[model samples]
Target: MPFVNIKVSAPEPTKEQKKQIIAEVTDTLVRTLGKDPAAVLVMIETLEAESIGKSGLSLEDLRSKK
Candidate 1:
């Protein structure tokens, strides 16, 4: 089994985008690693912007500056 974890800062991905992501990732694994589609697991995790920091600033704060 192949497990893939994708983490992104929220507002999170839309349902359609998530579906596309899963499908594309599965296809990639199947094509590149000869993995079974049924055995590939893709998990998407969204973290709060406030919880993620970069360059000494929280993602929330960084976005607010834009």
Candidate 2:
């Protein structure tokens, strides 16, 4: 079994995007490691932009710069 955990800052992915992510990740594990799709676990976690930072600036701040 393969477990994949993905974390993103704010503005979570849409349902269709999440579904695609799960399917693609599962397929990758199946193809590369011979893992069963049924046994693969994919988790997506979203955090507030304020909680995630880069270069000493929060993601929310970075977004504001854009």
Candidate 3:
């Protein structure tokens, strides 16, 4: 079994966006990792803005400081 974990700053995703990302990622893993796409598990978690960063700044503090 192959396990893959992906983390991103959580954002609202539409159904089409979700399906597209899942399909593409699954297919790539199937080819590169040589694992069955069906065996791959994808977990998406929406994190608070405080936990996400951009331009070397936390979203939470960046807003207030700016």
lDDT of each: 0.98, 0.93, 0.74
The 10-residue segment with the lowest total lDDT in model 2 = 1-10
Error of 2 at 21 (Å): 0.4
lDDT of 2 by residue, 1-66 (tens): 678999987699999999999999999999999998899999999999999989999999999999
Q: After superposition, how far is residue 26 of candidate 1 from its true place, in Å?
A: 0.3
lDDT tens per residue, model 3, 1-66: 556565655465767876777778888889998998779877555567789888998887777787
Q: How many clashing residue pairs, candidate 2?
A: 0
Q: Each model's TM-score, in the order given?
A: 0.93, 0.92, 0.65
**Which portions of model 3 miss their true places by more than 4 Å?**
53-57, 63-66
Best by TM-score: 1
Q: On a 0 to 100 scale, what is the lDDT of residue 19 in model 3?
A: 72
Clashing pairs in 2: none
Highest-scoring model, lDDT? 1
Ranking by lDDT: 1, 2, 3
